[model samples]
Target: METDKKDKLIIALIIGIVIVLSHNFVSSQKSDDLVFENISSSLDDKKQTKLINNNDNKEKNEKATIKKIHISGEINKPGVYEINDDYRLEDLVNDAGGLTENADLNKINLALKLEDQMRIIIPNVNDKDNNENNMTSQLISPINQNDNKKVDINTADKSELMTLPNIGEKRADAIVEYRQKNKFNKIEDIKNVSGIGDKYFDAMKDMIVVN
Candidate 1:
């Protein structure tokens, strides 16, 4: 009877140890699942934050970036320049130092869109060859022909005086200085200069006069 009691006591102790170990194992599994869930949530939040930051960066870069344009041909200043996306043709013209005095603004479409390496051509008032020829013809033609034997250097324009053969801006200017200094009495007084001789005076004798 004593042996049977000892066997029962040993079996009860073994069963209590298994129950305690199983309870601890279940609690450990729950704790591990919660830790994994927290780690997964942390990783997801990091991904979302990174995605948002990238989008913000892209927007900022787009706003800060400026496009450069290369323009040439017939502008006042032709070269490479940078302009914002909102800038227009008028703004570009101003940045390029505006147009030349001879530039024909009426012929071009100033409101047209610009592009990279674009050639902005401000055409001449007329066709190139025709314009040049017209200018030459106008230059050769005389204006208000003087019939008397006098030349008024002070009042006459440089172009008018330069119409004489072999006369240039410098020589015309010299004649004006001579007239101013001596207050010419006759047309022969112009012969005092080195380049202007009696022959040159005779050639221009009919073309000039004085009051």
Candidate 2:
């Protein structure tokens, strides 16, 4: 009877050891899984942070390419404007709500590139008493008496060009197409159009202005 009791005790001790070892192995596996999850979350957070920084840099570069300029004199809305750096003087005039009625479009170089903090001055056509420096610097053209009354060939559309003597739809379209490719530098430059000649110009000399 003593031998049987010893055998039973040994078997119970072996079973208890096996149970303890299984519990330890399961706990170790769970701890490893938790560590892997934490590492993956940290990597994801780092990637998100990097993406946000890259976006911020791109926005800053875009803003840097914008130019700030001040436009005044004869403009409808003269003050400050923020625009693209490559914008021209003509674009500036349009941005300032277009030129005033008396603003001279002939003298200034409209294709000039806008720079940061630059001041753009648009002179009036009626400033007849401009100084020698103003004439030399701004290159203001003389205001002809017929300018206000005559049809401006430079700005007139095809319909307005057709109002002239001997000008039909085909002739008017040719004038616009020619002007688009080669701008008229003077009132006499209208003769360069397909249908216009010396005789035609003479008849309409009093009726046209380059302005």
- Give lDDT per model, in order: 0.62, 0.71
How many clashing pairs per prediction, in order?
2, 0
- RMSD, each candidate, Å? 18.9, 14.4
Q: Global CA lDDT of candidate 1, please? A: 0.62
Q: Kindly list the per-residue Cα lDDT of model 1 for residues 54-123, writing each as its tens digit.
A: 9999999986775666544446787778877776667888899887777656555556555443334344
List, residue by residue over 1-211, the lDDT tens digit for candidate 2.
Answer: 9999999999999999999999999999999999999999999999999999999999999887776776666779988899885788778888899988887666467777766765565657764433333332332112233445678898998777765654556667888888888888898998888756664465466678886
Model 2 regions lying over 4 Å from their true place: 1-22, 129-211
Task: Estimate TM-scores for all models.
Answer: 0.35, 0.50
Candidate 2 overall lDDT versus native? 0.71
